[model samples]
Target: MNKRTDIISDHVISALGDGSEENFKKLLNNRSGITFHKSGKYSDNTLPLGAIEEELISQRVNGNRLPEGYTRFEKLCILSISEALKGIDIDITSEDTLLVLSTTKGNIDLIENPEMHHKLDLWYSANRIASYFRTKNTPKVISNACISGVSALLYAQWHLKEGNYNHAVVVGADIISKFVVSGFESFMSLSPDICKPFDMRRDGLTLGEAAATIVLSTERKGRVGIVKGATANDANHISGPSRTGEGLYQAIKHTLDDDRQIDFISAHGTATPYNDDMESKAFKRSGLESTTVNGFKAYVGHTLGAAGIVEVIYSVWSMYENMIIKTFGYDEFGVAEKINIADRNIKKELKNVLKTASGFGGCNAAILLKKNE
Candidate 1:
């Protein structure tokens, strides 16, 4: 028999809130975490961002006292993982358990400080997180551009199905910093206002910071589980995505079975012209142009490495609530093909959902999730 892997428990700490359910509640209430910033902390230019307060981070984790030596990046991972573990009985130290860290730039904030170069290694951060939790296995680290989170989850699922481990703790995070902000600014991809996904007036993406963890176990079934997943790289450009949506189309085609219907799509709608256009073309080619779709970037901004996992967790919450949220900044449809962009919240049965992500280096991924019967 093939082992089944299911998402058991999860937690999210973003500008919106700390818990996964808490963030979902704020979304339902039409509260956005993205706010315009005047301070030159992250970037020299004033722009809107989904940033969490430093004081809040210091006071929210581990009874208001975080352990010593962990960077801000590490702190976010530990706090999120700790809270997620509260809902599950799986032992982190068990030999059958595995830990995985997903991030695009772990401790990249320390790049300017040459003396702190030791903390710049991604492996060091992953090892530190594993050591903090006393896990028996060396944690796996994935830094696959913006697809890190989804890649990590898919990787964990593969391991669980292969009987290499029974449980997998996957955490994806990236904190806002000068290095991160400047890079986007250079790309001219930082929006001055809240991001608008699939809107005619859409401009650029808003950057955000977050850490999200999802625990997957093969030992038992949960409310929802990943049914199929596939990744494809078009090798279109070093930093630009394929304009034809070739990679994403391939991923969606591979992930969906012939008879399965996708109720809605959690799109990688970054609000950029090329990305939104490419996604629309991909959905059209996959014969899903009319399927309802929504993007969470307007609420929490584009959360780098955490975007995939964060969006997936919110999708799960929507499935449980039996509702689909409107794209926050989306009003008029603007993509090349006609796709159903949710302009209003609709309550309905979301039995099967598709989550997709596209990133630089022409990477695209799709994951099909089903509500367990």
Candidate 2:
């Protein structure tokens, strides 16, 4: 028998907005958060990014009444979790509940600050966040690069299935800072304008800041259930995706669990030359090329650790509305592999949706979801 997990409540703090309802509305209206800003970090040059506005960030912390000593990333994490648990009946302090945090670089900017360097460990961040809820067990932190969010969710699924924890809250977050921006700049992997996923003329990806949370419980009270999930690492290359898409293919194939038909695919369309191509190859190999595929990176920019969790929440939104979100900047087919890309809003009965994410270090994770009917 397969263990079942339900996504009870979700919240997202992103460039688009705070709550999932607001963000989904904006997405349905074809709104984007990518913007241009003059930066002093990268040689005083103007860079187009998907950063959350300063005003929104300020309001989020102030409105939430977060602790005064918390850092920006900490405030974002706590705000997202608090919002997600708003009306849920789960007792956060119960020993039956678990907390999992997904982040690629926790306080990466602090590395440059001599005083902050002493507290940059990811475990420290996770412990601090969990302390707010007074959980019985120390929160688990997953730091598996860009796919960390999906990995964390998968871990929670297995943890709940193990008959140990009745409920698990998974949160992922990453913020754009000079430390992360300069590293991507060094690789010239950033797009100059809004990213165009699967577009023939696509240049590169744009980074965004976001924190998203999803609460999973073994009980079937939520509107969506996690059907299954899996992860695969081909180790094809240390910092590059497998050109053959083997890693991503295995991840998706396992998640499908013998179900050949998926209503839609929420892909990790980073808009880079190689990443998009690899995803197309994977989808085609998995016989999902005919499914309407959409990428959220164009709307929110590649939000690193938060990408998977935020996109999964958006996929649930699609299921809730029976609508397929248009690939924000996908204009024309550009990949060598032929795959159906959603360029316009699609109104259809969505039953099964697959969420996939791929990051540096050849890591790929995938999970399946079904609308709770």
Candidate 3:
């Protein structure tokens, strides 16, 4: 058997709140961080979004242990990574350890500060984060659109299975900026209100920003086990999912292997019309149509690069706690195909889980995790 990799620690900073405990509590109560703003940033027009309150963001950044010269994005990433590393014994400076950073846009917001925008270079941002930890190896960065987080996890999994690395610290982050907001606006995909992932009235996604970090170690034994994962692209379109859901279906199918059973699914549920429908079709083809599924987008909005990691961490928490959280904004049946979108939280002995994500470039990825027992 391949070496087993487990997530020993996780830290998520989103509109949902600071850490896993807080985020989990708010998720169960169906709290949403999305709010409407009639002024400042993005555009002068009224815009509803999922955003970390300015006060909270400032507090977290100001409290960051890292020194100054770090951008807000860097501060968020450092705070999350520091949170995950707290009380953990592994030396990040050891060569047996590696860092994998994931983000669709790192400091893209820095464009407003051209003197500092040079730091927006993803590789440079990664090195800064790594060097902050004094990690000895060149940090690996993944920028493969929205699936970047999951891809980083799988990369860590591969390294562990190769019997070379003892531990991997994976951090995914992205801050919403005028650039991203305007771009999504151009696509007409921003929700005017909190997004409803699989609801009949759902219109579009609410943009969100967050930095989430997890400590993955083959050295630790925990209930959260990284089993297997796969990625595939249907080459359907640059921005739209395949109507047949071929790529996503294949990714889920391969990840499930012969098991054909998972206690639940953490769906990509961007709430965009095509995304939700495509996922429904994919679930159907993968024979998981009846499986209970939920999306966290309504709670934290879609954190782009951080979405997959934060959702998976939430799933791990669900597995350990045996509590399935309700879909925050789901009210009515919405998808063209039949799939069980959890209308309410269900308490079940969740021994296994499946997580999925799809993004631009027609890419899709799936990951399966099981309780360590």
Candidate 4:
């Protein structure tokens, strides 16, 4: 029997050109994507966010040869996966390669326009991308609220360990629409400006859309490796996390206990009061209070279902560059926990890192990764 290691061969992260480098120097220097759209009915009180440059999307699609009828989510997924696999000289045979897609609302925009309602089918979205790449294996789609992206990675790890597949492509995407905007507005979760995580003035989340993809395999070469991973549910609350953050704390403890030298942590700091407070409690309970922690929501806003995978890409890239990216809008820590919130860029040699996330239904997941030598 061969021992298996969770190895990430390559990864591609898609963000608005403006939110990324080149057009903007860094996240801290760019204007927030949150804006008011007072033309629509919900616009009176709701703020709509649109970040990606249309021309950039066009360029990516043309370069990747994506189909014209593909929805925004599909196009983003195809582009990110294509880029992530570029120059990778791996032979993926039929039945050996798998594709897992994670999204909260797949093609939900099609439903808004009755003429395109039929195009919103989840199977079609999954198969279209698989067929485009000429993969004979059927793709798997997971829509587990906000944790869908991280769950996809967990599923891939299990299947690889079981020898069901040799490699897997995990992609996550979700686009903003009237449906998503209005729903969050109804819940009073949308902030009028960019989100400020762990701040006394924090209000709500700023919605953003993105697609991030990563290639995972049992083979480890020229890639970062997943050292450990664990998932748990509080079973204590239906719509919110347990006040004590029991599930999150357990997930963190499980990941760290296996390897105690985890240097950095990428927190799911959505900037929402309750979520941020619960995560702060979890960090303290896990005894990782001294570890450097940071949030990426300020840079890309909260990408709903795509947050897990997108943040994973950021964490890996930060390690690769040997720099810890700043938590753009963080100002203060309001929690009672003694946490090290990273408010400035720091250069450090990171050996192992932990990425933690929690979602609706009290679902929590934590993954540990080691930088490749």
Candidate 5:
């Protein structure tokens, strides 16, 4: 398949199990892992979110050290990737393997506690995760807001394509903290209830936390392959996207141009009016109106940095099962340009699929995957 340079060997997705089984089952039910955080010291007026239960996190890892106790990002990364790599055979030498992590707020949870915050730093958090697997390669961490996860994937793909490494482990994760919640609250971008993406009644986003990981290699098996990937910046605004979605449109166009038949698209769908409108416009501009579009934000809320790889996991799983999951809270179309959203479970054989992500700083990324033949 186009003389594959890099292929995804396995993907592992982790979420709180308190939600619907269908939500946790696979990619088709559109179930979100969000729940009400009654223990936090936030205002009750805040919206519900897809927060992983503390009990679940505790069950996965055991320790009281700062890296183990305060670094939620590291813990989630270790748990998620460790599960994803279960039973997979790989030869990881320092020169042949690398570990790439993407996160917007790496171990910000340490900052929540004044005592821990004073002692923790960026390198400690980044290295803690890398040391978990005893990876000898210098761990690379990308903190490019929401686009970090996809950026990590793109970096791994480039390295593999260039024959720099034989294998790479990519992990994306973030945790809910008062800092992030308050940041979104200050921006007035948080939804008070369930997020309704591309719907007439859409309001804002519900921030969530999750960890998703993927193993990439230059070997192909019965799995998905990275066909194409592109990243671009709008250079328009820092916190806001371009009105016309120039970056997103370009990213999607370039990816689709490389492969004409894109069976499904995993949309960013943050449920914010601006992001949804921009994404819908980008899809229309790319002539992807007829392609099956799916959104995982509704199911997982906006996982910030983790959303990129989290959504990719959903897209890959959809391809594995030959089914398209509907957007969870979407009911009516509100955008001026009409684009197709997978509103119901549809079983269809898919070959080429596109996963797109956008974040602050006007950054946009699109990754294409083709089903194994």
Candidate 6:
């Protein structure tokens, strides 16, 4: 047993709304933030996307206007971290505090534009965000494909347990760009309409953009905190996940250890045929085929690097509210394995919840959040 890493405060900025509560409220109402996009910004064809309005970003930030010279990506991160830091007692300037940034593509949209090549670097963007808050330490950045959010949280927890830092502000953000959209389009992975996770009509994933932040400390600052986390790679194809679900299962097995009684699971249900099927197989392999599971993608539209942190924040809200939100677009159990996918809101006591993520390069991550005793 190690010192527990507890979440202090958290925030989420998505198409649903600003704060975690706002987004959770929409979930309770079965409202989705996904919208149809016909703009030529992402692609030539119309696509479904979960993008935050520029006006919202510009208006909700600290100054009601984005700071000069800061890219949209940087501003979104700052806004999320700033909201999470509101009224908290943590001294971000203290050397005992660390900042960790998680994003698959940080300022990657600047690649095509000139005179900002340095801003294209993830570290540069991370430092900019940290400097905005006057943090003393050089920020750590994680860019592990789609699992960056969970990976960043795991890194913070490991360092906190080791007494390297007293507090860590982990923020994950990613915005959809022409470059990113075109890459996914090349693979034909984007859904033409709202995604259907684990549903028979599911075809492809809907891309999304968002920034989510979570503050963690060794002390119990909140009612829920991370208990354990693990990661495993199955050495599968670059874009395709393991069909047997061995990687995700191994990660789940290691994360749960002796405690297999998970109240529910926040799955990485991308709505793609392979991802949902693999996750189902993994749940079956872990003997958790009966645990209620739900995917947040239907609401947030697969927010790339932010998916892990965003979904984690939503899961925390579920624990606090003691309600499991339904899989938004799932009306049928379409996965190959017979897993219990939550199609309706479930009001049950949640003491422990499992959050799982799988990404490119055969990466899989699982983290357990337990109600503080």
* Per-residue lDDT over 43-77 for candidate 4, one digit per residue giving the tens place of the 0 to 100 score: 45646464455677788888777768788878877
- Assess each prediction's global lDDT (C-alpha) against the native: 0.89, 0.89, 0.88, 0.75, 0.76, 0.91
Clashes in model 2: which pairs?
none
What is the alpha-carbon lDDT of model 4 when measured against the actual structure?
0.75
Question: Which regions of candidate 3 deviate over 4 angstroms?
Answer: 62-64
Among residues 3 or more apart in sequence or in different chains, the pairs in candidate 5 whose N, CA or C atoms overlap within 3 Å are 32-299, 34-49, 34-50
Q: Give the CA lDDT, 0 to 100, for residue 256 in model 1.
A: 93
Task: Provide the TM-score for each candidate, comma-separated.
Answer: 0.98, 0.97, 0.97, 0.91, 0.91, 0.98
Residues 1-373 of candidate 1 have per-residue lDDT tens digits of 2777888999999989888988999888878899898867787788999987677678776574667888899999999998899957899999999999989999999998999999999999999999999999999998888888888899998999889999999999988889989989999988788999999988899999999999999996689998778889977887887878899999898899584588989999999988998999999989998889999989888888999999999999999998888789898889988888988888889999999999988899999888988
Model 6 score (lDDT): 0.91
RMSD of 5: 2.9
Question: Model 6: how far is 141 from its true place, Å?
Answer: 0.3
Error of 3 at 69 (Å): 0.5
lDDT of 5 by residue, 1-373 (tens): 2446444544433454422223347445455666666644654464688877778667666542224343567777777777666666764436688788888887776675787774356567668777666787888888888888888898888887777887888888787777888888899988878888888888899888888777887764547877778888888999987788899988877776745688898898888889888888888888888888878887778888878887777777778788888888889988657899878888889788899999999999999988877
Q: Which pairs clash (backbone N, Cα, C closer than 3 Å) in model 4?
A: none
Best model per lDDT: 6
In TM-score terms, candidate 3 sits at 0.97
Number of colliding residue pairs in model 2:
0
Error of 5 at 112 (Å): 3.1
